[model samples]
Target: MRVAHLSLGDFRNYRTAELELRAGANLILGPNGQGKTNLVEAIAYFATLRSHRTSSDTPLIRAGAGAAIARMKLEAAGRDVLLELQINREGANRAQVNRNTVRAREVTRWFSAVAFVPEDLTIVRGEPSGRRRFLDDALVSRHPIAAGVLGDYERVVRQRNSLLKSGRGSARTVEATLGIWDDQLVEFGSQIMLARRELVRDLGDPLSAGYRALVDGDHGPALHLSESVVDTLKERGVSRETRAEGSQSNVELADVSRETLAQEFRDALSAVRLKEIDRGVTLLGPHRDDLLLTLNDLPVKGYASHGESWSFALSMKMALATLLREESPAGDPVIILDDVFAELDSGRRGRLMSAVSEFEQVIVTAAVEADVPREWDWNRVQIRAGEILPAGEQTSGTPEPKSPADTDPAPGESLSTKDSEQ
Candidate 1:
């Protein structure tokens, strides 16, 4: 699906802004600190419901503002859907679809986008938590309902951990109470684990193909889940060592039934019960799992070269986008590259563009016009100090920041602008 229009109020640096986008390539060109990333972040908010830049929603609302308003007009399969979100600084966020109120999580079901940002390198080079976030985010994008499952699983983990911490010195007293949490943990955690395994299994082929397309070498890119439940069943604390030793590939998780996984999860909890009370933490669950990204039999985190790591991360995203395109009824997920071309070499930049060029829509943000591929006739828009300028506006020299009155849409005026002439 393509974002036909995006409107923002008090989001990031934008006080009030409206951007009109078109199908195929659209480029947002601006210098540093000019809200290029913020623009795309707002569009993606509907898809993932979280910012790629920050872990908290407070930073998304402009300073001194109580809430940030983001409204998107999307088109797919001859349908138009309007998704709106009010990100609050203090209270629960609000959402709407086609002007009808919905549970905030419901907004994700209408839009699907795959964003490639500079931080993606962290997926390969960073800590296990980053990789876990990658898996959970992909799960949400694939099936919006997975968002609820993830939320429930996270709640279960938190409550279970609380019980574990409270029972630190009184194991016998809290044992019965802990059993209730354990059952809840297994119930929700097993669903997450099973969904994750299915996602990893389906991503295998597309990931391999994408890696080959980007690097032109089959470094044999692969995904392996170092599941806490599976590892605990094999041997205590095996999942903890998966990263350091790079032997996570040995864990087999594909085609495991939920009943089997639930039993294993229970066994894992039983295996770690007393130790968990002593440690005051839930020792085994999806929360502790790691998605081991491998290239040519070695873990990407410790062994892959810088270039190889970047390609693997990018390929992982492309693989998800491909999977979504194949399964989604709404059409291909919008491909977003947020200042990503600037990070790649000339060869990879062209290759990356070509790799995603066939999607229904691609929106790119770049500080320099030359960083983007020039042959596709990009629909270009300019941004300056949070203001979105009209189509084809030149930004070669530093431009004075426009006042809010200059760009804000007039009351009842249409936000739609003619598709910028290529």
Candidate 2:
């Protein structure tokens, strides 16, 4: 699916803006700080429900505004779907599909997108949390219902942690309530772990091919899950390894039953119960697991060079995008490259463009026109000082300075409030 149009009001630097997109190779070009990433971030927000750059929604709201409005008209399989979001600064966010209000997570069921940003390199080089997020986001893209499951899992963890902290009650009382929480935790966490295992297994082939396409030679890129439960099982007499260190070291998760996994999960919790009670935290389960990315039998985080890390991260995203394309009846998920071409060498830039060119739609943001490959017929939009400039308007050199008239909203002007007033 592709976004046919995007509308913004008080989002980032845009007070009010409208952008028309096309089926293939749409480019957003302007100098840095001219809102290039913000536009694509708005589009991607519908897919992931969070910003790639920040963890909080407050920053997404334009200063002095109570809420930010983002609306998009999408086209897929000979039909159009309208998706809208109002990101509030104080209250919960709101969502709409085809003008009908629904739960915010429901918006993801209608659209899918794979965004490649500079921060992706962190997935390989950064902490475990980033890698965990990558896995969860991939799961949600593969099955939108997974959003609810993830939400449930997170809530269970929170509630369980609260109970652990309040162990002031009688020991029997605490144990009784804790057992109920444990059951819910295992029920949801097991589903997540199993789904993640399947995702990693399915992504292996595409990830290998994607990496090979981007770089020369076979580096033997591979994925494995370093599961906490599996480790606990090994401590007992399960005889299964979590890492894909070698043929014998890898656990064939396909053959592993959820009943087996649930038992292992319970065992893990029991082993850690005392420590968890002392620390007042829920320490074992999917939240503690990690996706171990490796290249040529070595961990990518510490062993891979800058170039190799980029290739792995890019390949991972491409693998997920390919999986979504093959499975979704909604057509290809919109491929978004947000200022990514600038970071890659010329060869990889061309190769990356060629790799994604076959998709139904691609949206790219770049600060320099020459950074993007020039062969394709690109539908280009220019931005300056939060404004979508007309064709023939040059946006080279530094971003134009914003004047007061450009920054300030007119009297009685607010997208969220005005719509309600109408």
Candidate 3:
């Protein structure tokens, strides 16, 4: 999938902006606070309906505007899709695809992209929440339908937590009502756990290969899908049924079925029912899980050096992009490198560039033109104070900004110069 053109209105610092992109590589150049990251961020948000930089939608909209609108001309599987999104501050966001209104979540099916940003280092060095988010994003990228599954699971958890909180005083009533929420939790949560375990299993080889290629070290990178239900039982010394539960005698996670997971989840809830009511929360589910990343048999967070952590984070994203290329109906995902090259050393920068150069389209943003690798044929666009000016243009701050672009440039006119020596 590729974005042929993008236009933003009342989004972040951009009152109005538009740009036409190419298939190979598009380089967006600007100094700090000029909306370079904001431009790429808007493009990525169209894929995930969320931001990587911040957690709130209020910051996404212009200060005085009631809403923000983003529209894209996407090319996917040889057809053009017109995707429009309206993000309102006081109401639910809305989306339209091919001029037909649809749920905002439904827009994910139209395009896909994998972003490599400096913040991705959190996957290796941060808390379980970050790793879980990494897992969920990869799950959605692999199967768009998984997004709905994730939404259902989150809703069930939230509703179940509300029931647990409000009905705490009456033990009998709480138990009875909790049984219903337990069934739904086990159903949705078990499916999520199964998918996550399978994803970690499949990522093993690719992550190892990518790490080996990126870092000239003997450390072996491995991913372990740590489940709360199993770990809780293990901590309590509760032995699981071996061969009777549709698993091998040892009950390896890879061999467990959804039914096996559901049964275990149910048992776990039964064991911890009273404790959960006391705490006003739901436990023993995929939401409590973590993706354990290790290097040389050690956890990467507290043990690995800074360089090692960066390499691991980069390898994981690269491996994910590679795996999805094999699974995606679209031949290649739109790769966005947002101010990432500046953070990497020269050797690592060259290696990273070589790793992703083969993709059908790559978008890179840099504060200086020289920071980006100069070997490729780059379709360059210069952003000056939230305006998409032609390449090599510069300006000081203007008193009154122009309205967002009414239309993008003609197809071929957006490129300042196309590198000819492929």
Q: Candidate 2, which ten residues in sequence have the lowest lDDT sum?
A: 413-422
lDDT of 1 by residue, 223-280 (tens): 9888777767667653432234434332345555678778778878888888888989
Per-residue lDDT for 112-213 in model 2, tens only?
Answer: 999999999999999999999999989988999898899899999999999988884335436878999999999999999989988988999999999988
Q: Tens digit of lDDT per residue, candidate 3, span 1-422?
A: 78888877788887777778989989998888999998889998887778888876778988888777787888888988887777777667777777566777788887788999999999898899889988888887777778888888999999998988887755675787778878888888888888887778778777887887777655899888777898776666667774233323212666688887888887777778788888888877888998888898899989999889999999998888888888888678889999988888888877788888888889999998878887888999987766787697665654232322344322122111221110
The TM-scores of all predictions, comma-separated, are 0.90, 0.90, 0.89
The CA lDDT at 62 in model 1 is 87
Residue 273 in model 1: lDDT:
81
lDDT against true structure, model 2: 0.84
Q: Pick out the ten consecutive residues of candidate 3 with the lowest summed lDDT.
A: 413-422
Clashes of each: 0, 0, 1
The C-alpha lDDT values of all candidates are 0.83, 0.84, 0.79
Checking candidate 3 for backbone clashes, the offending pairs are: 16-404
- Give the Å error, residue 378, model 1: 0.3
Candidate 1 residue runs with Cα over 4 Å from true position: 236-252, 391-422
